[model samples]
Target: MKTTLVLAMTADGKIADVTKSPPTFGSDRDYAHMVEQILLADVVLVGSGTLLDGNESSEVREPDRALIQARIDRGQTPQPPQIICSRSGKIDPQLPFFSQPIERWLLTTKKGSLDWIERASFGRVLVCETADGSDIDWQAVKVKLAELGVENICFLGGSELAASLFAADFIDELWLTICPFIYGGSAAPSPVSGVGFTSDLAPRLRLLSVDRVEQELFLHYQVEKKSEDIPPT
Candidate 1:
């Protein structure tokens, strides 16, 4: 499976503002570019906190009918499933993300709580776990996605999920849009957060391309994963 992480950050590498507002730095053009990538994906994976961030769902924009039809022509679903991952499964049922027409799936650990979710008929529940702890078994998740014919996945989650996926070396490509503003604060989150990597195990990026539109700069990189970077199967 090919996993890509897409996000926009401030000039100082802050994904959120000091007030922790939903990222509004990117321009409409950046959003249109993101939607186009989402249209090409087989599934969209996001964190539960991101889903409840008071914004509308990540469902593809209706204005892009031709893009949807392009996917259909390639034998892909018109609307891909949006998978939300939570270690504790504490998503609020009233969030607007759940009311969208696209399929919604919850990926969580076995010990996570999901009473409200199951009863709500939101979508399928995929419990991904490792024996060591409640952390997601990413390898298993990849296998399952493959089983479901998911060849390309777009990740639009928060920093923690981004860190987890990057740490596991599951992410293949990264698309980042750097806005002109600077939101410098300790509380502001970056593109990757959580227990970070040491020098030896850090993932290296091979820059593929760079594009600048006005003040925002878009960078595309391919993650170079060494043999040891991949966890043993």
Candidate 2:
């Protein structure tokens, strides 16, 4: 399976403001670009924080005709399912995300899945706990996604989830839109958060492309994987 992380950050590398609100700084062009990326994926994977932060829904509620036709031509669902990753499975049932038209799935630990087992909120509940039982095992999650025939994943994140996937070396590509503003607070979140990597252990990237649209710069990068990092079958 291929996973692509898509984010729009400030020039100073902040994905959100200090308040951690849903980013509204990106241009309309940037949003279109993000939707394009999402349309290419078989499913959209997002952290619980991102989903709950702004009461967001992953459904493409008003997709353009061209966008719908593109998916149909590719033999894909008009809108991909969204898989929410939450270690605690503590999502609020009242959140508007549960009422969206799109199919919903949950990626969480075994204990976390218990509350959702009898709920109709999610179409599928995947349990893949780490050895310590502290978090979702992303590697195992990857395998499960593969078994479910998820060949392409669009990861819409809130830093921590991005960090986990990067640490696991599961991210295959990145699409970053650098907005014109500079949000420089330490509390502001970046494209990747959590215990960050040192220079030696950092994942390398090969520049794929760059596009300038108005004041924003859209950057695409392919994550260079080491030989030993090949994913398990």
Candidate 3:
């Protein structure tokens, strides 16, 4: 699938402040841009933590009516399916997203407990695991998503999941909005957080476009492979 990471970061590349909560630094235009990108995707992904952090819904909001109509004009669904990735499948069943009309799927490992089985009524529970006891194998996840006809995936969530997708080279595009603010601290969270790549093996981005709305700058980049390449997913 063509995967895109959509997020807004501060001037210092922090997605969250020292408090470790999702920052609210971007403007309405940035949010509208994100909704537009979401409308173009076949599936939307969010980490469990990100989902529970707020009462976010997978359904397209009224403000995004034009973007939703754009998708409908192209023969796409009004709202793309939303998938929640939780290695252990421990998300709260009462989360607002579960009550929305949008299709929801839980992509998790077999190691997940049956404690959340009762919540399966809310959405399809896909238990994927590997013999090595590692996290839900992303390769299997991709194949399964493909079987479900997911051609484009919009990743909108916390940095940990974003880091895994980047490390696996599963992300194709990055639509970043850089807000004109600085939340500098050692604990500030970046858009991609995990054991990152070394300088020699870092992923390179080819700038596709740049747009400015007041102080915020929207950057669209296509992930590119360099000489010292990271293998594909």
| Highest-lDDT candidate | 2
Model 1 CA deviation exceeding 4 Å by range? 113-120, 228-233
**Sort by TM-score, best first: what order?**
2, 1, 3
Worst 10 residues of 2 by lDDT: 224-233
- State, as a TM-score between 0 and 1, how close model 1 is to the true structure: 0.93
Query: Which candidate number maximizes TM-score?
Result: 2
lDDT per residue, candidate 2, 87-194, as tens digits? 999999999888778899999988899899998999999999989888988789888988988999999897899998998888999999999998899999988888
- Each model's lDDT: 0.84, 0.88, 0.82
* Best-first order by lDDT: 2, 1, 3
In model 2, the runs with Cα more than 4 Å from the true position are 228-233
The digit string of per-residue lDDT tens for model 3 on 1-233 reads 79999999999999888998757898999888888888889889989878877666556788778888899999888898888888887777676777787888787877674666675534677776677755877778788888878899999978899888887778889999999999999898888888988986778887889999999999999997444443464
TM-score of 3: 0.90
Q: How far is candidate 3 from the true structure (C-alpha RMSD, Å)?
A: 3.2
Which candidate do you rate higher for TM-score, 2 or 3?
Answer: 2
Name the 10 consecutive residues with the lowest summed lDDT in model 3. 224-233
